[model samples]
Target: MRTTIRLLLKTYRFEFIAITLACLAMAGAELYLTSRLDALALPKECQFDQNISVEQGFATQPEEPVSDPTLVDSCQEKAIAFSDSDQRSAVLMSFGAALPVLAGILIGVAVVGRELETGTASLAWTLSRSRRRWYLTRALLVGAILGGVLLLPSFTANILEHARQPLIDPGSSFNDGGIRGPVLVMLGLLTYSIGVVTGAVVGRQLPAVIITLALALLAILAFENGVSRWESTLAEWQPAASSSYSIDIVLEQDYRDRASGLIVDQGSVFNAAPQVDGGPDGAWIDAHYDSVALVVPGSRYGDVVAVETGAIGAALLVLLGLGLFVVIHRRPD
Candidate 1:
């Protein structure tokens, strides 16, 4: 067992080291960027209590000027809803996570691929190693070594928003807790798994790499056309009105269930005053609040996010599983 482990580890040592170094370096860069951002002061609206006038003669005041630091600390953009840094981080991490897929595909093809193309795979299995052990060990080696290297960057990225994110009011994403880190790690492993599984099936390094790349293209198209098109959840918190149609939450499941011609206008929600204070009712909206509050009839925020989230993981699982199964069942001949 020790010999087999050592042999495999030796085979992948360099690749493992490279991945680890890359993860560490990238994570370090992210941390440094985060620190730099923290140092930069941003424009924040100070909501002082307007009630108590401070007389120059008296120190006693009716109300204290309270500062909600969270407001000041958050990153602001034009879009109020999705202006949080976490959402941007999640999107960036999603693309960043895909980077490992390319790396994994190349490495996966290299591990057993070069051996088979060079006629070393058959000889080694026939002379020294059990075929089943070889396949299983290689899979675990690719999975573990690569998975660990990929996991490190994401784990480190979370340190940025360590205690700032509260469940009661999920703050702008500064950490990896929500979707950024996990998505990156997941995409990396899935892509690498595809490459390894591809190699196992093709039994050649370079060809398997090519095949994996081709398959990745198909996955990309399907991911975009099918999963991402649903409900525009990608930019939900981004405060950007990228969607073609306005969203309405009705108790009914489909749009057909709502009143035929009755359009729900959410122009008010966006136009409404952002400040939370003891101002006159609807002071933000500027009038008799004729606009209705956008309601999600039966669904909730969790449901929307979950649907999009599931699409990402589910697509990865489908591709990785099918690729591995085919490779495992193929005959040695």
Candidate 2:
């Protein structure tokens, strides 16, 4: 196994180098953009009540009075700054999402598919190693190389998410949760597995690559949909003070059936204010007018990660089993 891996590495050393360099470039860009945004101080509206003062003179005061005309002009550009940062984040997130597909196609076609097409895989099976061991070693070597290559992008994604902490919806792609870090590497592994299996089964590079990509896409959609359902839960109510919540908080403002927990209707519940305090009338208004926000709090992020990791891991295991089955049953030709 070690000899096989070393020979494979010796042959593909340049290709691995190229992949590493590409990932580094991607990580560098992600870090640079996210770090710049992180360095920017939060605008006044976003920083509300971050540091409140109880003293008579300091209460409700802005963090600092802007006296310079230039500084005042810059202050007015907060919206622009936020927009730019959001755009950068969106770009990075899109790349992160597309990575598995790319991996599936590239690795599936280039590594196993191409070898099978040229009969090199058959030749390898004729050597000292058993077919099962040879296939397993190849799979492991490719998986390890791809996983290492993908680490930079994964780390960059995590860094970008943490740098812009609490700046996006909990259910949104921008939130790290399971879409970044080890989860992404696992996703890539799953994709790679699918690709290699497809290639080995088909013994045609282009067709195997295409099939691998399609399978990877379907798997990703299924995984994402499942994770979404797992991550969100019903909340009976939320506080009226929006300032108390971060942007990562996801709230569903739908009218639900009290008995069935089904959302029967949708509209704003907090439409009016109470006229007075401490009465049946005031209590009615408080109960009715105070909207019930079905919130998914940031505290549940860990749960999201755990559920997604389990789902992805299960998928990887299933793919591995299928791949092994194909290799084990095949006759040497």
The TM-score leader among the candidates is: 2
Compose the digit string of candidate 1's lDDT tens values, residues 140-170: 6666677677776666555443311212112
Clashing pairs in 1: 82-237, 82-238, 82-239, 86-173, 113-205, 249-296, 249-297, 250-297, 251-297, 273-284
Off by over 4 Å in 1: 41-95, 127-130, 158-179, 224-226, 229-333
* Candidate 1, residue 89: how far the Cα is off, in Å: 7.8
- Model 2, global lDDT: 0.63
Which numbered prediction scores highest in lDDT against the true structure? Answer: 2
Model 2: residues >4 Å from true position, as ranges?
42-73, 165-179, 233-237, 240-251, 254-289, 331-333
Quote model 1's TM-score: 0.57
Cα-lDDT of candidate 1 = 0.50
Clashes of each: 10, 0
**Decoy 2 TM-score against native:** 0.75
Q: Local error of candidate 1 at 223, Å?
A: 3.2
Q: What lDDT score is found at residue 281 in candidate 2?
A: 51
